[model samples]
Target: MLNKILLVCLLFSAGSSLTCKWMDRDFKQYSESALALLKTMKTNSTNSIDDIEVDDAVAFPNELYKHASKESREERLSFVAHVLDEIYALFEENQTRASWPENTVDDFLDIISQQANGVRRCAGKQTTNHHKKNHRKMSLYFKRLSRHVLEHMDYSADAWEFVREEVRIHLHKVHLLASS
Candidate 1:
């Protein structure tokens, strides 16, 4: 009984964090039309350009949304912060892995919030100005994220190359998510 209760609590915690992630992403779009565009993104099987096309996107927002039904906002951020921790751990695995500066939950929150805000902004805007606002916001957020990533990037040549490749895969997915 104790083990079952612990498991339930763990699952509950996970659900909340994922919901927060969804909430953050959903809030980014401001306009109804923009949302329709976002909804059009295709679900993808691969996360790399070489494996797929840079322009090709399998937008799976539903899959992402379904995940939100389980968590509260704080739980969601904590969960994602944990995921970020793991990613960094992988990057810093090797003794020669170079400097992968530590990232806090706030860092993940900063990035997630920016991305979500962009999406929410797009969703809220009315379709009048040929999507310039949507594009501009996404571009700005993406650029900021790229900069943050660069700041924490590993300096070792081999490690650098690997993480760069890793980032490319993730960025592609982000592009798919920002389809609106």
Candidate 2:
């Protein structure tokens, strides 16, 4: 009986492991495609000074990414989902001001939404305060970025460039999380 139980457990674990690998492959493809689209958009855009002078300090939450990296797989998936959600909101809010092709923007957003859904599915419905603090910080960062882009940047090429770089960095972080 003991040997039988052990064998069954081993088989179940192996099956789940294979399932996870398949899911990861899908996640990786989504992330890669998003990154590639961003790259193409950036390349086609006019060259402008990448630096923007802002009165306030708006920074990416590196600490959040670092902490999430050390947590369990579920936690990492949750963080990526949350970040993608926030990015989607930001992009939706500012899409009107972007000079990029509308179809490209739509495709990018669609991919992001799909990727977020996949991550959330893998993360399950468990909610924890483990990432609440960093999540708030990230929310604030996007809010500030929105304000800057709308009020100050307007239709400036530099503003769009700044936005692209910030978004690219966030997507790169998501890719890293998914890869791990």
Candidate 3:
């Protein structure tokens, strides 16, 4: 009886370990795909356009990255997933105004959604309430940014460019987190 119990425990541990490894690989692949899509959207123009500035009241959370570094893998994944969700909503809301190729925009949004879904699966949570304050701040930041892009930007291209840059920066941070 003792032998049987030990055997079962060992098998379960091994299975759990394998599942974790598989999920990590899947998450990494999704993150990489999202980054690649962002890269393809890069523009060569360095000309400065008077773009809508980020609101100080809901500025990008630079400190969140530091906190994320210390967080558990699932916590970090959850935060990134939430951020991706917001980005998807932002782009989807303004899709009609973007001058980028229709397929490219669609693919970008699709990849972001997939990445968010992959992380949420690994974390086993649809949304996290751990850093509730930070999450709320982020949500507001994106909302204000989107409004600015829509109403303040001089042209549709400027708005799309701003969104692209912000997405690329956030995705790059997520990629670094995954690598770590």
Q: Model 2, range 1-180, lDDT digits (tens) per residue? A: 999999999998886676566455798888788988887777345555344676555666787789888878877888888899988887776556566787887899999999888787777646578567767777888788878664577756567667778899999998897668
The list of candidate 3 runs beyond 4 A from truth reads: 1-19, 44-46, 49-58, 125-130
C-alpha RMSD by candidate, in order: 17.2, 3.4, 3.2
TM-score (all chains, Cα) for each model: 0.25, 0.81, 0.78
| Highest lDDT model number | 2
Q: Which of the two, 2 or 3, has more lDDT?
A: 2
Error of 3 at 132 (Å): 2.3
Cα error of candidate 1 at position 24, Å: 12
TM-score of candidate 3 versus the correct structure, residues matched by position = 0.78
Off by over 4 Å in 1: 1-70, 95-162, 165-180
| Backbone Cα, N, C clashes tallied per candidate | 29, 0, 0
Q: What is the C-alpha lDDT of each candidate?
A: 0.38, 0.77, 0.71
The TM-score obtained by model 2 is: 0.81
Global lDDT of model 2: 0.77
